[model samples]
Target: MPPLPAFNPSTECPPPGRFPLTWDEIESELVKADDFAESSTRSGLLEELRVHFALVEMATGAVGRLWLAGSFVSGKLDPEDIDVTYLIPSDAYVRAMADPDTVDNLDNLGTKDWCVRQGLRVDAYVLRLAATEDFRALGVTGAMAPDDHKVFESLGVYDEVWQRCRSGPNGIPRGTRRGYVEVVL
Candidate 1:
């Protein structure tokens, strides 16, 4: 891998939507994600969840925390795919979507797009906070398809893995033991 240029944070256009959150706000969400992953891990799922976290951290930038939804988090022992979502700034979303380099890179999110493009089970949505709220409130209204509604309604943040991911003096108690890669901003 080569050293990339510093993120200017000024060269990208925001994606079309509402509820774009700042980087710090997204970190708070990560805490929730850490907890969720911790609570849901069984013998077969922990490594998959950890790998997903590592890949998202390694490949993504300028995004908020990752979300685990669908059958994986809904108590299904064998989920077809690990449905992961990320709350990214609209501008960052636009930049990633347009960049050819980001395509095909799972860590880069090209794999995410490709999975969606092929209608694979690894459901992914890079949405804003407002969009998330709408999904929560509307519960898959008439405007949204039934399958889409199922995915949206499956956002479960409650469970044992709800432990904090942070460590050290400023960290929360019962924090996670699984290793994680911090998302590049």
Candidate 2:
């Protein structure tokens, strides 16, 4: 949470089988949240992910985005398995094969293998530009909405904490308001 330990791009090493990312590369594309908490602990975790996504994007050459999704974003980090979604272009699989050093596809097996090599727990999915039934079911509408970007831009841990710590028993959070965290590229 302590301002995420001043991300030093030079010092960051990519997870196993992944390439390293430079601080400048990530800083150039990094997005800042309008609302950030004073707690360094929470902030550090977020920053770590920012770097991670930057690397993912760099390695894949596919537009990538990260969201606080899952229990952590919903202010329920106690569960330990923080759900995160990494949106990669559908062509990422092809790209991986072409550039083995930077990208590697393990089939439709979600990017968990990659994440595991890096010591992170994640649920990654490749999103295609084409509008398919699966895409529709996932609620992706070709491009990101203004509000959607705003939500990511203004993301913070406040709401999740409030909903969990303040909600009474049997008042579990539900709906799009509580179940998901979205990140787009």
Per-residue alpha-carbon lDDT of model 1 for 1-185, expressed as tens digits?
11221211221111111222333433343323433455433323434444554554444455565554333432233445655566554445456657665544544342555553544445454543223334444544465433444333433331112212334563423333221122233
For model 2, the run of ten residues with the poorest summed lDDT: 11-20
Any runs in candidate 1 off by more than 4 Å, and if so which?
A: 1-41, 106-122, 128-185
Q: For this target, which candidate reaches the highest TM-score against the unseen true structure? A: 2
User: What TM-score would each prediction reach against the true structure?
Assistant: 0.35, 0.41
Model 1 lDDT, residue 118, Cα: 48
Q: Which ten residues in a row have the lowest lDDT in candidate 1?
A: 8-17
lDDT of 2 by residue, 1-85 (tens): 1122232222121111212224333222222322223333344445556656666666667654443433344322232334444
- Root-mean-square deviation of every model: 16.1, 13.1
Q: What is the lDDT of every predicted structure here?
A: 0.40, 0.40
